[model samples]
Target: MRNKIRIPKRPVDTTMSKTTIPVFIYKPEILRTDRSLVVKNHTVKPVLRTLLFVLTLICITSAAGAQTAEELFNKGLESFKWQKSEEASEYFQQAAQADPNRDIYYLYLGIIYHQSGKLQEAEESYSRGIGLNGGERDRLLLNRGNLRTAVSDYDGASSDYSAVIDAGGPLSSSALLNRANMELNRSSFLLAVGDYTEYLVREPESPQKETIEELLNLLNTRLASDAQAAATAAEQALLEEERRLAEEAARAEEEARRAALMEEALQSLSSSGEDTKSISAGSENIREDFEDSALED
Candidate 1:
């Protein structure tokens, strides 16, 4: 104000007055870059969350779909117990398909088939069950034996029953009784007696006393008849053997006697020849005639 000085005007593009406020720096590029980074983080977060949720759902579904073989087996048994034959068959078939290694499934299936009167199917099922494992083989054998007996297949029944006997356990008495019945039907008295005796031996003493006594009486009658027949056969065989031996001895003794007589004759002939050698020709002739007559007599 004391001395007014004229300030030079400067070009806007080149220079600024010292009194001018410094121009504010507008960093538009930095602001835009930070905003883009925020958007990227937000987008990625949602995608990652969606991926995790989908994975968890898949795991849950997979776990739910899994079921144990034994659980399915129990379901099949329940179906069978309700007398739903067709439904039971389907359940068992499924179980068997799921775990073909289990023999009990096949066994149950066989029983169902038999009850349904599907004999051939039942037989096949039982045969397959037996082939699978030995644990229930006795039951299969006993059932088959019963089937064979029903069909009058005595030989086959006998074979199966005998197998049950060899397998042993509580089924032994039933098998023995069945075998005896088969033998009785076939008129195999000796075999029937043997089986009946075995049954009696294995049976309990108290409850079956009267029944056993009756059976024993019948068995004893058959056994006595068999024993008498056996005795008669043995006696016949003995008589034939004795007759053969006696005939052989008589032939041997006759041969010995003939040999001794021939030897004595030869000795007598030799002595007579020596005595004749010292006699006159006519005396030798007479002695020869007398010796010939004596030999002839």
Candidate 2:
């Protein structure tokens, strides 16, 4: 049975068939698990995009904040030009706070404070601005000196003027003039004269030349008159004291002479009294002798 089975032979056929198949693309469903996962991924993508957008916005806002200091300063200047003092002060204050190291900010802040009648605050702002090493430092110092002068702080004003002089700037002439005026007000006449003379020498064509000359002439005349008056007063006082002393000496001499005369008169009277007493006794003795001789006779 195995040999009979082996006698049957298998036929082999080779055939090649070619056919075109159509591919279909369908939209993903949102409700199914896999589709839902894809949708979640898309949703998460949007959330990440939103987060990135927010971060970008934060960065932009930070950059804008960085620029706000200079912008606020310019805005303050515009407000000041418009005579909006309070608004200008507000803007300037914000600018100063935003950029404390900026000399212009502090300087403008000082000006706004001064305009608003905050003199102390203005002085502080000016000082801060001066400390910032800016180009306008001399101007700020001069302004502060003027303010100090307005308050009758002559020494403080002089200090500012001295600083300007030491700095060797264009403001020196005006500062010297102001310093001279301050010295005059404080009655430091000699110092004022020297400063005024120096100022005149430096600025021969100064507009205040006439006024300075007048003040100097007046001070010189007054000082001379005072010296003359003082000398006259001293001479008169010396003469009066001499006259008083002479009169006192004369009175003392007269009292001494009168005392000597009184003593001499008392001595003469005593001698006269003794001589009269002796004569009376002798006359009595003679009369008694005469009576005795008559009785004997």
Q: Which candidate leads in TM-score?
A: 2
Quantify how close model 2 is to the true structure by its C-alpha RMSD in Å: 25.8
Identify the runs in model 1 with alpha carbons over 4 angstroms from their true place: 1-68, 205-209, 223-297
Q: Against the hidden reference, what TM-scores do the models get?
A: 0.50, 0.57
Q: Candidate 1: what lDDT?
A: 0.71
Task: Summing lDDT over every window of 10 consecutive residues in candidate 1, give the lowest-scoring window.
Answer: 21-30
lDDT of 2 by residue, 55-77 (tens): 43443234335457887687678
lDDT of candidate 1 over 1-297, digit per residue (tens): 022222223234221123232222221212245335222345445555555545434432332225345655675677688897865676677667778777787888888988888877877787787787667777776777776776788898898789888878678688888888888788887788788778888885637557756876887887898889999999999999999999999999999999999999999999999877767677978988999999999
Instruction: Note the Cα lDDT for every prediction shown.
Output: 0.71, 0.78
Candidate 1: residue 57 lDDT (0-100):
41
